[model samples]
Target chain A: MDSGKTTKEILKAKLAEGEPTPLYNPEALAKIKDNFAVWKETVVQEKDRKNWEVTPKTILGSDIPRSLLYTPIDNENLDYAKDLGFSGQEPFTRGLHANMYRGRTWTLRQLSAAGSPAEVNNRLKMLLERGATGTNLALDLATVQMFDSDEPESMGQVGTVGVPIDCVEDMEAIYKDIPIDQISASIVTHYPRNTSIIFPMYLVMAERRGIPWDKLPGSVQNDFIMESVVRSASEYIPPRDDFRVQCDNIEFIRKYVPRWNFITLNGYNLREWGTSGITEMAVAIANGVEILKDMGKRGYDPDWVGERLAFFWSPANDFFEEVARLRAVRRLWYRIMKYRFNCKNPRSMWSKCHVQTSGVSLMREEPMANVTRSAYHAMAAALGGAQSLHVDGYDEAFSIPSDVANLLALRTQQILEAETQITQVVDPLAGSFYVEALTNKIEALILDEIDEIEKMGGLVDVVDSGWLHNKASRYIQREQKMIEDGTIKIVARNYFRDPNLEMPEIWVKEYDPALAKAMMDKLARVRSQRNNEKADNTIKALIDACKKGGNVMAACVECARADVTVGEMRRAFVKAFGLWKTPIYA
Target chain B: MASKKKIRVLLAQFPLETHSRGIIAVAGMLRDAGMEVILMGNALPKQIVETAVQEYVDVIGISTYCGGELALGGDLMKAAEERGIKKRTSFLIGGIFPPKDIPKLKNIGFDGTFLSATKEEIVSCIQSAVAAKN
Candidate 1:
């Protein structure tokens, strides 16, 4: 399709579809066209702003504006069926599910944790009882990520941030009496222990409870894209070796636990680090493609693997901008699946995601104002058609959420789901001329960023060269300067003064002496009772798998069988893989 | 006309949780008051103590939006006390400080608590903390 012929042909299609094409209205088209033409002319005709001449302003992913200015003329050629398709159709830009929210509302997954497993269990029940669809578990930093509750490096840390789970017994004690199969449980753990300690503990619970394996519905977000992005360059593990470990899990999960979602591409963290929406989308799609490509070469079919794929994205403070982002993600993913991968299944084309509101946008000033901030962002996510949503607690800017603060955060989502009547339909913002235009603009911008990253050798390259980190640091610097200089006025922050309203108080969960004593005693008993021979053999097997480039999850399962703690598995990896050292910024 | 003595405050925007909004605003407030506010973004407790010692400021403030404050705060204060630095500096906390345990923080050696202090209140609190320390 030549430019001239394509324009004319697209115009005819638009008019036939009962739409106003920019070409038909010559005067209006000339205005927009002329503006662009003049912009190009001026760029070519004039000297640059700085020391030298002939420069074009570059749009770093961060330099791209948060919200694009779009118009109806932008979508003149958009076909409802081809472009903005139905909720459950090819290129599902609208939604993934057939009925969408009309069938059921998105899961209200609140981030919850406490000092002890029992406390977290109580909190989980409280959130579930208050209309939360799933339990979002945040593990204690020492226990979950590093794997040792009593490591000197982990001093002064306990269940304050998340529940402390030291053994299979702790996991069992935490979920005692709760129907695990009935509800979805979401856990956030990214250490070596996930394959070894965590995954098997849950399997054991399922097997013991007589629950069918297919009935287990939950999300395990194990992403290694960042290992290439953040760790590989630091020589934490040789790039090839990291790939081996990641591919091992993907292969293991593919064959077993067909119903479970193994890896959720966590583009949300990248977005939180100040990457632009387009960069986020570009990296996300590229990351997913990399994982799929590697797995396919390993003989796993894309058809089976795509069903297990999911995404997690951050919904920023820009309300309509976020809606446009989600729309662009769905549209672009559908295209990639259809054209790039040649996957025939519609589910392969589906883009399902979970959104957590922008933590950067929350203000410490008038901390109560965050309630309103989260409420609006939650609405944006709802309108954007998120599969699951977590609204930041109003007190999130302060400490761990007091019970009242956490309850209020839950209520924020409840109000949207129950009182607002916004959940009555799926794709609530569909058919908006402005929204469609924004979606197209976002799609274009994302493609440009993806192209730039591809040129740099993809997401892994950008991460290794410290380019992504530099980009984030530069963006954060600009935002900080703006907020500091009062260029962007934050209410109760740089602007208005409210001195009299006392900050609301929160109740911090304390370390329970009884629980700690019970844990220590339990730890001692497990140490004495578990078969030492079995544990030693499993550790050796895990190490051998690493050296042989074999699937580690199988060895991980054996480790769990021997009651090897999460900490022990972590130590084994550290011994072999080494710790990730971040770049030192001077 | 006598110029007001600058509070010379150091603000640590620690990510106890994921939220940075509160510290960003509070830092701005302190800066507006002619205080030399240093932003230590997402530092661990040890790094925070090291920064506090290096900066040699009149006051040290830490913010946590994540629920790790109690554990973070207790260790931070303990570190300060061990260094014999607790008496010389005033520590103020912002973000979601539960009111029920304000006494606990006080007992742990935080001079005053800003449960969710606005920028203005935060600045004022810094001024008073600096004065009390002097």
Candidate 2:
């Protein structure tokens, strides 16, 4: 639990000797190959023992050969002190802090669904009252896409998936009377331009409430490259335009909002899209590395850029793999930030992140069973040392979580925090033979994937080549087939087939139809009431900024204050940067 | 003749600007199974129906998350009917839709339901739909 390595100490020896050596011992790895050969030949070939055909759910070692029992031989190459260091030190394989949860508990964040701003505010208040420390705002599709509730394209889906915020007033209504600057508020959005919309609204909201813009807290998921590569949401706008907005917003936040976590790459959603944990993490890191390189080109140091960055991942049903993946990403990012990018500040090497339990792992058939599944995911995330966590509601597969279900999800985390003694020790699973070996394997897999991506130019190029999309699609297709063929199993849906089982009442409350209407009416009223000339003028300035390739955040703030709705801003952006050629069916 | 003709299927999201994750995967599955897959990223119901008529596609597969599909699926079918190609084209939908909405999807005249359908089921449905179209 000591802060073992100084940046000077680790950086001096390694950075002096050109490229950094691999974390594992080369001689020991060669010996493992020898041992594995004999074990496979003698145990299986000589004894005529047929090992069961086991299919792996993880990315690595699927179709390729794998040993049934891993041992000290497999982990002989691993160096605990050298590779892992102490938890608080460089190459933070264990965690960012030495004592971890014993020193401070992770922020308890719960996701919100679509509603009127007032309705969503009530939900946030209820969540805060229930011991939640962070508000992970989930914007409706219309809002995320920067469409107004009344837009013809957004008709049926308004306020369905998340809260619909049309302008500054709507955003102000969402946090009404809740102390805006005190708690963390993570704006969960993807499209870079749309995400920039919320930043101005948050700043303007604070300005009106007599709070400084610097006091506003929380992170934004502004990595549109990841959206393009893995999440498939990048198809909403041109990749080049998205990347430009990302750099502009991050630069703005770094200058003004010093306390805010300016940017994050949420790979959890991509896991649902069918990419494996290691692949997704590798892609996320590759995207981060590309950002570091871009910052260098723009005369910004890697130190300041890395300081404002965070990551988000999913802890899936594959318990050991998920644990290993969490451990591996930290180590990999550390190596990349320090050795590759030469980030001088020690804070830049640390990978700060939260883990969300995989919603795709939840099944609609047996809603009660999901409660247990979510608990285990939370436990895995905690043990693996996530900075924060969001447990999926038991009824998530059916609809937006009911109040009872959301409360129970919070209880799952609280029990882990209070009743369990898992928080007592740091990295409890650190030295387990299987876990250590698996962690090394995951690291190796991620490095290999990163190498492949680099060889294909970079993350942006990989996305442009359309390779990442095809890769994810292939993995998803294989996964669906495996489940169908009984290679992978879900409880009641695929395996149980309980004909007489009656599904329990899952939907405690359906989304109110009146709320969507109310949101539209509020948008109309705000437009009618606010300064039209100011809105028109500010929008033109925003369009000029976009055309001149200038930072558009300030212009956006002025527009927001003038009650320019999201829909109008969308047109201004289109007029300046042109519309993306949406993929055609034919 | 239809079996010999490499059946073309148009894949899309139900005209609301949702993420392209679900539809992208199914497009891969259909393409791998020897069907010509046209990925319409995120086209509206009318755009989907027009593409079905214009391309002379044998199948139209769309996915939605919840609630919206009930109306959008109905819109697609209605648009297809107005174009007089509703009978010739097979309509299918998929997503983590609520059970209550399943009946409404059926009422909208979709040829097949693919709520979380597996690879084999998707391929088999596409094949069956193409054969039915023939």
TM-score of each: 0.78, 0.89
Highest DockQ against the true fold, candidate: 2
Q: Is model 2 an incorrect, acceptable, medium or high docking prediction?
A: acceptable
lDDT string for model 2 (A1-586, tens) is 0123332234345645644445557787788778877877777664343552343654221232245666677666455565778888877898899889989988777786557778889988887897777787888877777778887677677777788888888778888888878988888866578767777888888888899988888888888754455433322456667677777788788888888887787677666666788777878887787777777777788998898799988887878777888898888788878777777887898888878898878886768899998998899999889988889999877677887888899899999999998999998898787788888778777777887887777777777666776677678767766666777767887778677766564563334567778877887788888888888999999999888977877788888888788889878887887666433321
Candidate-wise lDDT, in order: 0.67, 0.76
Task: Write model 1 residue lDDT over A298-371, tens digit each, in one string.
Answer: 77777778877888887766677788889888987777666556678888878889888876667666788888
lDDT for A550 (candidate 2): 73
Docking quality band of candidate 1, CAPRI definitions: incorrect
Query: Can you list each candidate's DockQ?
Result: 0.16, 0.42
Q: In candidate 1, how many Å is residue A509 off?
A: 3.4
Once fitted onto the true fold, the runs of candidate 2 whose alpha carbons sit more than 4 angstroms away are: A1-55, A58-66, A230-235, A499-505, A508-512, A581-586, B1-6, B17-19, B28-34, B116-134
Give the lDDT of residue A285 in candidate 2: 83
**Clashes per candidate, residues 3 or more apart or on different chains:** 10, 2
DockQ, candidate 1, vs. native dimer: 0.16
Q: In candidate 2, residue A59 scores what lDDT?
A: 23
